[model samples]
Target: MADRPTGDTSLPPRAAEFLELRPLLFAIAYRVLGRVTEAEDVVQDTWLHYQDVTERPRSPKAYLSTVVTRLSINVLSSARVRREEYIGEWFPEPLLEDPYQEPERAAELADSVSTAALVLMERLSPLERAAFVLREVFGFDYAAIADTLGRSQSACRQLVVRARRHMARGRARFAADRRAQQELAARFFAAIADGDVDQLRDLLAADVQLVTDTGGNAPAPPRPIVGVENTVRVLASVLPELGRVGLRLEPQPINGEPGALARDREGNLVQAITLETGEGRIRTIRSVSNPDKLTHLGPVADPWQLARDYRESRRRQR
Candidate 1:
């Protein structure tokens, strides 16, 4: 991931323009590509390429969005192949913080970068995803989206329509009450800490789904766990193990929704979880412990090693 610039207030006029739009550029790239590192790479590439344009554009935002969108589409093209060969269900890397949080369109922006929404986006063609993100997420009109994708305005509209249709097929009707989500999450975390199966079961919908992506050998099933009973069993089983392993989970906003982050005793991030709630119940739980995904948050402990340590601790107790 490109390191965000620090301690540099003395940028050239053009560079300053790029810096001002960096957040939007990164947001566009991330929402399209669904990967922080690749999005950051696109942002850096946009900056480098933008520096070479001697004549300033009439509109910097449009130009920057166009460049970053194209670069992200290119990255997503190659990324598709690896995703097909991935061992388990591939999830977009968890995003802890959104760089492009637009207050006026806050809910739309939040839902667009959401884990569930991003997962559905993976099914879309790169252009379709880009078009949808530009139009739906960022409020870009067809003309602007057309410029970004190098297509006619009508064609851009078509892409958005198709992408929206594809996404709607799998989209859940999530409750939009932020405060309700927070309150539920607080209770759910309390249940997890206590390993209270009944409360956990109560908080989850009857058909709640838990999808975990470790991306390697950690403590997660390769297949998804579905239903309240099955989810409760898995969650209850793992909750105690976390204590044994000296890992702690804290409720945090992840991807603009109520979620949790796990850390080891030494404060190294180990896992991230995003909760999707609806009708006052947790419907989907996304757990991503992938080391490659967690590195951006900071020092990522080796989950594989953590497993070994847990086993050793078990042996010592015996």
Candidate 2:
């Protein structure tokens, strides 16, 4: 039985245990589902299921893990269709802060939660995603993973292997230097705010991809703008428009990567930009502008309406 919080002694022993491991359970579900709301629902559902258990488990963490994974997989089964029908490019909802922290596996933890890694994992089946996350990202043994999924150890290993093949690009990643990432991000956003197309070009890799997901709620390209020149051109064009609309950009860390948060005049978050870097330059610029995704950050504004307002303002000026 885990101890209750100081001064809150009425909390049940098992309930206290669940409270302590809530972050880990949420992390497991988030990695499996890639959506904050769904992952959180799974955690709550796990607690409800745990309350009904009559006997104590040998390991509370294992029990909680199994429950959360199962709930997350159930959600994932139905999520595939919704994702396919999503209005625009569907990226994982940006997370401003991760509750779970594995200091011993910090590098692996960071890489696994990256936007690129989550997008690539979308190719894997639901069970494969669960098994691979438990075994590879969290370093669970084969036996425990199998028990969690109610599959044979060999079957679990096969799922992980296949998942690895699908997500090979995410393998063996090391955490980037935080200071370096922040410094680079500072310069990059400064260039955007200044409308320095040439500086933006130099900061971008030769084959960078600028991807934005507005989910059709806001005006944006439906697909990624690939290559340095195209990305630079698009970025440069948007600068004046965003400035006209009074959408301010500020440097911030998003999903373990250097990124920025954009807000409209009302201080409503309009965009969460995450930058992936390699070779000392930006490789991918993922911006999640879908207001639904930005809810986690804070109040979200109507970017499409903002777009119209700014365009109308330009017309009046003309």
Candidate 3:
């Protein structure tokens, strides 16, 4: 009789190493793919590739890094094809909350995952994006990045430099004072909840736009709501009825900016809201309610502490 298939429980030592690196691998993949579901899929495919190799790698970090980089590169290459067919404007998948809030660390995480940065990255060639992210975001040295990309260190350096210049050209340099922004966001939410259209109008910038992502799965406004008056009127009309649906709103941080966490009466996290500020007025109001996008913001934690831990980890990794 054929030998019985060994369960994961009977896997060898390398399996344990793979398990240990899974979280880090997933993080890398998510940053590259911008979607949690796609990132998870890439990591699983990496694991399968690892399983197929009979020879064990001397350095699991190097092995896993190679697997993730190649997978990310492959995804990036294919993504361009699909993005061309995407409807309307394309934006990066927003992070619901900053998991690491130590100022420097949070900033680093924010820099890597921010909507602005991600959108800018879309303009780069896949190799350039990978090189820049690996070197700048993750602080991988030229030699390591070269090895991962099968290029010379000098070539990797040039790719990163080009990517940085491209990003600098496309990105807006706006610094957010979290406390002040949070206070404003709270007021914005309160205005909506109370049907204070005048307050909402005063708080919103004249050109303000509100984008809601329901993932084409739920009942959401058909098009993006634009202009302060239109946004306020639509929200004022809808929010009062949210109480009847058992949704509650709580203040939360989104992408290191002031935002809100919406939950059901049962206290399950349902959505994350972020406001963009310009010239002391809200320029944009973005609500991410697709359950898939809100997974990162489910249980809120202190942004400061999260930032601290993320910085420490990056320091140690370097």
Q: Where does candidate 3 have its weakest 10-residue lDDT segment? A: 300-309
RMSD of each: 2.0, 3.0, 11.6
Q: Write the per-residue lDDT of candidate 2 for residues 1-318, one digit (tens) a residue.
A: 323233355787988888889989989998899889888878888888888799989999999999999889999999999989988788898877788997887767887898888888899999999999998888889999989899999999999999988898654253467677778889999999889888898899888888888778778886789999999888887667778878898887777788889888889988899998876788889999888888977899988788887778778767
What tens-digit string does per-residue lDDT give for candidate 1 at 1-318?
434444378866787888889889999999988888888888999988787799999999999999999999999999999888776777777788887767888888898888989999999999999999988888888888888889999888899999999999999866589889889899999999998989998999988999988766467786899999999998887678768888899889998889999999999988899899999999999988888887878998888888888778767777
C-alpha RMSD of candidate 1: 2.0
- Cand. 2 TM to true fold: 0.93
Residue lDDT tens for model 3, 131-207: 88788877788888999999999899999999989998976556666567667888888887777888888999888
Clashes of 3: 7
Candidate 2 stretches with Cα past 4 Å from truth are: 1-10, 169-177
Cα deviation at 210, candidate 1, in Å, is 1.2
Score each candidate by Cα lDDT: 0.87, 0.85, 0.72
Models sorted by TM-score, best on top? 1, 2, 3
Error of 2 at 33 (Å): 0.7
Clashing pairs in 1: none
lDDT of 2: 0.85
